[model samples]
Target: MMEGTILTGARIFDGERFFDGHALIAENGRVKAIVPEAEVFGASDVTKLDGGILAPGFIDVQVNGGGGRLLNHDPSPETFFVIARAHRKYGTTALLPTLITDTSEVTRLAVEAAIEAAKADEGVLGIHLEGPHLAPARRGAHLAELMRPMDEEDLDLLCRAAGEMPVLHVTVAAEQVTPMQVERLTKAGVIVSLGHTDCTSDEATRLFNAGARGITHLYNAMSALSHRAPGLVGAALDAGDVWGGIIADGHHADPTALRVALRAKRGPGRLFHVTDAMSLVGSEDDSFELNGRVVHREPGEVCSKLVLENGTLAGSDLDMASGVRFGVQKLELSVEESLRMASAYPAAYLGGEKERGFLKLGCLADCVHLSDDLRALRVWMAGRVR
Candidate 1:
């Protein structure tokens, strides 16, 4: 049997803070300790890294596809594995395979696939269903015909799925879902997030009070924050108990806007980074099908973005590591803060912080080794290298 493993030679960031001249020890797929290098004396499998940062592995909650696989295209356990493996290369140790606005049959298939995949892969956290319950006006890439109000049947499926999976996140618009529905969904352990809506600030807050705790891809598909009208964007920033997810790709929201959000956001509920990644990530393809429509990757001078032929923004080509770099280099956030936005904050949003987001004792040994430039060099999930 294996005793333990020691990873040294890099600065360790334990989700909340940084430790220098320390070595991390892992055993039985959990963090054993983080001690000074001199104290790591026992015989163990040691992997020494060069000068860099060893931080908690990233947890992405809004990944639509990766490795050329789209959940909407193929809702199966194998597809989830493909997506997990693809994002794992970019330092994501755990992620929710997202499906954007699909039919009921496809949604049911995805729920089953996620339940099975969670049993096989620790990296497959759960599933994020980004709506058939959405506002048609704000449907960026989602087909308008598929958008509809949340009925009892829909709620029943989601509530049951939540009971069967580790996490079942659903995105809905306040206009499409009643507050009562939101309350029941939350009571059933569903992580309800508001998105793809044109609801007013008051309408959004009503849902927030009703049990919606998160805002998806903030400032993108929802209403904007204007002086006269604080839309969903304003409601999200102002709500202390609500968490917000931002794409952080330079193409989605301006760096200045993101910086402003970081400062203006309320406490206990801060803004975290999410890839909102699509099939373009970890793939060579420049385009993919979204709801039978072709979405092309348009190359920009600084970064590329996926858009439909009509020029509507699709998902994104961003990866978790690149999103972290953007938070630091573009948003002017400190390294520790940026890392937290990627790992700790999202994990907190999904209520997985106790195990997966931190490198403290008893936490899962999911760690990422990054270069000085913040690129992922090596990734380990549950103390085993991926």
Candidate 2:
């Protein structure tokens, strides 16, 4: 028998849409039911929450660091838990600890750390390798000295370590990766994302046909949408089966540009948001160091760089919750649609929509409560409050 709990007075966002509701029945860390408060009379404990919206806990497919620790530096299980704690305070209940391009030694350490984090940390979803296998021309913020050609041994070590962890996303330059290499990783159950590249639309299409299903951080770190070439962004827009990640902080990309992406990619369900956040997340002061390079924080932003000292934008200071607010308020996206981009769409990208990313029976009891202004009030991941 499983212990049960009831959460009342939430306007539930069921991944696809929202409905006026008051109570949810949860058992064994899964959503058991969504019903009126009066119907949940027999629960042993009832949490009577006040006016707020309850949606599936936000999922960030990319997180670099938080709480003054860089995953690249620490790359430890404890470091991941630290990142998870910092973001959970901001309403991200699940995330993939990301590692930017680094030396093969650092990459292996980060992968091993992520594996251990997945085992020990409940909020850690998996690892996202941003890459050594990237194009030098597009390697923004990544140490050029550490970038390398994609090789069989590199792929084998990462794949073997990741095993079947929920999300195993790797960003690569399509031209840099051999077709057979892409197919092999794809067939091995890795979700290949095209990013940090200068591939043409034709090359992007060829890679997608080979098996890439995602575009990492949409407009950034890749060739732009050109009329003549149509570039990687163009190919991603034309890719009907592929999902794309948009950084909606109003800094990385212009609001109108994001709207254009949504207009092009928006169907019944597509398009998601990711906070490529850095160590500045959950902190007010902005300066940090990466790979021995000093990074100064730009004014009026969370994580934008003030100089090219690091030759990159660094990571973001934005979290998933504020991303929703930016998408809705600044980008003029509808609340319902923005919430889906924050939650459901990413789950679909991971092929976990049927189980996670929704406020429905049998789904993981992961949810966030937000005030009228959309600030995080509380969060629950798999029925455990954080």
Candidate 3:
């Protein structure tokens, strides 16, 4: 016999689909059973959440920084947990602390820190190495001075450090990485995402042929969808198996482009949302420094002096729930679809569906209890809401 608590009468988002069930039993951080409302039993304690929606805790794959600490600047073990904890309050239960393109030493340190952080904390999933081996033209916030050619020794170190943590993402410029290198990385369980490149359609197709499974931030750091050339966007749209993440905060990409992606991909499973946030996330202090430049935040925008002398667009201050809110309320997507983008879609992206991403039997008891307006009511990292 097993005993824990029952979470009942709430909307549940399973990995593949949303289902309405009665109760879920979780003990010692793992789900024990999922029973209908009437059949729920064998629990000494219960929390009946009738009006709230219970879904998988959000999985953020490209978080650059949070809580006023930048990942690129610190790259320390503590920074990883700081980012995760800050996002957790906003319903992100798991996340990959992302590093922008930088020197070999900085990259190596970030990787080591991420590996160590994940070993120590349940919410620190891993590191997302987003550059240093990328085209200089599409390098968004990445320091161009650090961009370099793909070297075997550096690649090996990344692979060895990540081990079998389950979600190691390497975003390389499609035109820059050799096919053999891409193949080797893919075979080693690293998800190859195409980004920060100006690859032609044919070149993009060749990279996809070599097992590139994802496109980073969709239209932000890549070649656009030209009518004649089509580029990486065309290749990704045409490929059915590829899953993509977008910064749907209405700043990274336009709403029409998101609409096209949602339609072409047949829904939100392929078109998930990411924050791509900076240090300003969860901070009310309006001003901060990034790479020695001043950044100011106003209503609905974060601007950097480096990007534009007066006020140019900067990385977002958005959270997972806000991303969902922008998608549904601003982008005109369905509530169910937007919620899927926030939770289940990204789970499927990193192949975390089976264990960590949704509320189902045999999965880890990670869930988010949200209010009517999509605000996070409570967050459960494993089973116990914090």
> Measured by C-alpha RMSD in angstroms, how accurate is candidate 2?
2.0
Give the lowest summed-lDDT range of ten residues in model 3: 300-309
Query: Please, what is the whole-model Cα lDDT of each candidate in the order they appear?
Result: 0.92, 0.82, 0.78
- Per-residue error for 311 in candidate 3, Å, reads 4.5
Stretches of candidate 3 off by over 4 Å are 16-21, 41-43, 266-269, 301-312
The model with the greatest TM-score is 1
Q: Mind giving the per-residue lDDT tens digits that candidate 3 earns over 52-165?
A: 677788888888888988898899999998898889888898898888788888888898888788888558888898888888888776667778888889779866775746
lDDT of predicted model 3: 0.78
Q: Once model 3 is optimally superposed onto the true structure by TM-score, how far is the C-alpha of residue 32 displaced, in angstroms?
A: 2.7
Model 1 spans > 4 angstroms off: none
Per-residue alpha-carbon lDDT of candidate 1 for residues 32-140, written as tens digits (9 for 90 to 100):
9998988875647988899899999999999999999999999999999999999998899999999999899999999999999998966998899999999999998
Q: Of the pair 2 and 3, which is ahead by TM-score?
A: 2
Clash count per candidate: 0, 1, 0
Q: Which candidate leads in lDDT?
A: 1
lDDT of 2: 0.82
lDDT by residue for model 2 over 295-365, one digit each (tens)? 77776443354334634577677888888888888778888888888888898888788767898889999
Lowest lDDT 10-mer window, candidate 2?
A: 301-310
Regions of candidate 2 where Cα sits further than 4 Å from its true position? 1-3, 266-269, 301-312
Worst 10 residues of 1 by lDDT: 297-306
* Residue-level lDDT for 76 in candidate 3: 96
